[model samples]
Target: MSSRASAPTPPPSSPDTGALPMVQPAPSGSSPQGLALGLSAYVIWGLVLPLYVTALAPAGAVEIVVVRIGFSLLFCLVLLAVLRRLGELREALRTPSRWGATALASGLIAVNWLLYALSVVSGNVLQASLGYFMNPLVNVLLGVLLLGERLRRAQWAAVTLAAVAVLGMTVALGAVPWLSLGLAFSFGLYGLVKKRLPTPGHPVTGMTAETLVLTPVFVVGTVLLHGAGQLTTLTEGAGHFWLMAASGVLTAGPLILFSAAARHLSLTTLGLMQYVAPLGQFLVAVLVLGEHMAPARWAGFALIWASLALFTLDQARQARLRRRARRALTGSQAHA
Candidate 1:
């Protein structure tokens, strides 16, 4: 064997269409079994939050985002080079409309990244996690409205519950959970846009392009600001600086895994797995990080979980029904 550690096996790619007559299998091959096996990236994400708040030089959210974007770009570029995926990147960028869409998603990711960093540093990883928990519903809604996909009744109930939870959070905060909601909505919408791209670059390479696009501007801005003695937070210490670079690696690693998962799993299963990251964060905040959630916050969490539970059950029922229907159709075809 080669000395180097093997790169993690990516989640399998989106599978072919459902063959059964009654089942409408997802365009993406999302398997619940594979989910448990392939989804460690979220756990990595959960651990990284505490590391995030504790490190990162001056530790402001904006600068964290800047460093994350810079380093993630570097990490992603390396992966792309190793895999030779630049042809895919060029193909994605070749179309004008797709190029514009990529640009839009990139901008939204920047906003989402900054908000998430702020939420973590400001002692609200729980809130950020909930926001992500809310994302699948938003994605489902997008499918209904934008993609014209038909959703089942149980899925509808899940969406309704999620909306209620958002309202509950707003009432508790005496303000909209803007940070959480914004992150959820923007990232969710980013996925929707990518879904439409005829050839969306692999998330890893796509994200790298975003950073590369912004890097020149970011460098120029940094130089100008530092020249005026305005950028003092760049290097507080060796420890903080290295931690800052690690954020970039952290950012892209999960996306690479998720893209792999996206290929092998259905959107519904992916949505449920998405909860793993935030739920871990919630536990860590309460049990490890020692953050507290008041009653209302706890209630908000309950509502979100209830919504997700309904969503998962609904998906399971659908899968079962489809399997039965497939068997029936096979028998009928044999008789003929």
Candidate 2:
């Protein structure tokens, strides 16, 4: 449930090209700064966000998501104006394809946000954390299914392990973990849509457009909730009001930091760093939230962790090979 809201990186294609595509590595002096920013973003998502959502006591999940979207849209617009990026947003939207993609991405992300909020408020933080843990594997599956991408053997094995974990959990729990699957798949599809944007523009701009597309629906819902005496923002006291308003900052701040991190870090580093959020969530769920980890669930999580280890190792090995190849090519060119 942590804000998988970071700017989307395009997924890798078949192994004939490479197992994982490498973005430019962090500049020699900038890696530390990038690491810090990335860590901060993920920590806020994993550690801070669950606690923040739980504090919104009087508000239900729907209301929280509504307020989040509205405030997030407002915050994003202000950012566009202040950064003078409104024109860029306009240009991106001018393309019909981009607008459609943005709209779809908006819907997908809203589902993800709503599901995450529901999970946190319902004492299902452990499930939410599991979803995020499953997300990267879900992304790889999505790449293969939707993007016609081929997976390496290690990737396939990792994916199979994740599948086995899910199946085991379903059998043990006597019901499918639909919440976790919904969260994983929705965010994965959202990333896919964002990656497909013909004109992705700036991360903030894309966020603004997505929110703008959905703001009207949320606005109508807010009005309906108020009429039904369900909207609690104002009557819930000044503390609640501020917390509700702060959703905007909580939503957008990490996104900006993530975008900055992406600029300085290689895709490999960023990919590995993504686990920080889920790991934090896992700790918070068990320690702070006091969610029980049944033995079956523990086994499921162990499988997932093992799968992620395999996936990460494969990617790291590929990245090292790429770097060495680049170095050799540079040396040869210099000698020639």
> Which candidate has the highest lDDT of all?
2
Instruction: Please report the TM-score between candidate 1 and the true structure.
Output: 0.81
Tens digit per residue, CA lDDT, model 1, 23-93: 22255565765575447656766665555555653567666666666677777678888999977667767
Lowest summed-lDDT stretch of 10 residues in model 2?
Answer: 13-22
- TM-score each candidate: 0.81, 0.90
TM-score of 2: 0.90
| Residue-level lDDT tens digits of model 2 in 71-180 | 88888889889999889878878878888887887788888888899999999988888898888888888877886677778888999999999999999989898888
lDDT (0 to 1) per candidate: 0.64, 0.78
Q: Against the true structure, whose TM-score is highest? A: 2
